[model samples]
Target: MNRKLICYLLSSLLLLLNCNKVMSASWEITYPRTSSDSDKSTDYPLKVLALALEQTGVNFQLIPSEKHYTQGKNLSRLKDNREINVVWSMTDRQREKDLLPIRIPIYKGLIGWRLFLIREDMADRFKYIQKVDHLLKLSPIQGRDWPDTKILQANSFNVVTNINHSALGPMLSNAQGDFFPRSMLEIWDEIETLQTDNKLIIQDSLGLQYPAAMYFFVNNQNRPLAHLIRTGLEKAVANGKFDKLFNQTYQSYIDRTKLKKRKFYRLKNTFLPSETPLDRKELWFKPN
Candidate 1:
């Protein structure tokens, strides 16, 4: 190569390296791998997160966990690592304390409204559920680390806890738990993945409701990244990009839920973060 061309290439390389450093100076983010676990990994949380981060002009490289952390371990990893710049999960007082929460309800509050998954044969059994007390009698299954475990148990609902996400399906089908509750956005896609034997079905009659939201959480010490994420999300909301993305992503599930037709039982969420923007109607996803 000519000396002039070589000098120019070297300078260009140095400039590009400096730019990457500026972008990734704070944190490298991650979400657990789920492609093998799902037929089509929708990554709604990650999608919204990417949109918000774009507004901030910060550079982020999404590092998939080589540890193969399941949903339960993902929570633990967040508390232990500084490198996990972002993860999207349910927010509670404890999680907010352990990690710096962006406080934007990514799923809106719709994650709190749950639909039941049960054996196909048990659908008729839940049809007569007339009140919260009746629904409480049925055993519900949740991940050991999930906030829903504590949320349901506090409400006097019988809840079975397991650490593995894959095991919940078998446990429910084998009658270890009477039912499993999934959020409105998740039940339709998740049920398709779990119904391997065709015996597992989504119980259509009754739904569970709580006051909760999912937020992007970073390691407690990473305040700059948290601020960057919050700014990104706020910018998206300002430009109408956030709602447009949300509506396009979830419209079919919203149409299918028919919230008015289902009997819903509200449960109390003792650990919900008080800062949750309950006033922001535009941010939350509800099938009304």
Candidate 2:
């Protein structure tokens, strides 16, 4: 028996054993788990992904983060060994070395650098970001170890990568750094809560605009299965099921009474929770 041939055969067999014509064994969604009410893992994106997968005749076991997903012992395994097959809502470039990006985009958003805020008083020092080169020369800036940092570096912004976004708040509050760049949606609440007097502000600066955004990633080793999953997602979107899922997940976040503040698009389609919603009573720790 040829040793190289034997190894290839074993790898093929393992892939076959793990995934069937219908589905893969299970998937891991890498995200931060915290005490915040928004930390409910069973919410929107996961449900959208799972519903999309099921519609394509695929069945997946949703794996929740015991601790913060990105900061836990599990992420080390995911990074070093490529053990996690599928990760929901991951910025692509940072994990491309170890993880493969699905071609189909799960969501769309503008990816760019936003200025950190301590209070409204210091708004003078930090004005709008006009150029990437100008931002690089400033004091240390912080970001999570994801594609956001890569975008910053690509635009010539010197960034200090941290384990979590929460860590950057203290650094900025203590006057240690100039600003922290982060995804606007993910850190909106955290910034307002962490900054004293509830006076956190983000500068209007567009660093990068990624038109077709992704909300998840899969391990490079499972490239074949990942492609199939993406195809199912596209089908779901085309058939309107994905839109239903998106509305359901996004509705809880948007305040309906604040119609005057919302844009025309958001106001048009009021979101609704899934009909056959997964029992996430176990996942929610806070009172509704």
Best by TM-score: 1
Number of the top lDDT candidate: 1
lDDT per residue, candidate 1, 1-288, as tens digits? 999999999999999999888777754677666646443543777788889878888867677666566665676777787334568889889888878888878877888989988898888888888988888788999998899999999999888989887788889988898999999889898777675454888777689899998888888877877788899999999899888888899888977888788888888998887887888877876554
- For each candidate in turn, the TM-score is 0.86, 0.61
**Looking at model 1, which ten-residue stretch has the lowest summed lDDT?**
33-42
The TM-score measured for candidate 1 stands at: 0.86
Kindly list the per-residue Cα lDDT of model 2 for residues 176-213, writing each as its tens digit: 66666543334454554674423556543222232224
Kindly report which residue stretches of model 1 are placed more than 4 angstroms away from their true locations once superposed. 1-27, 35-42, 195-198
TM-score of 2: 0.61
C-alpha lDDT of candidate 2 relative to the true structure: 0.49
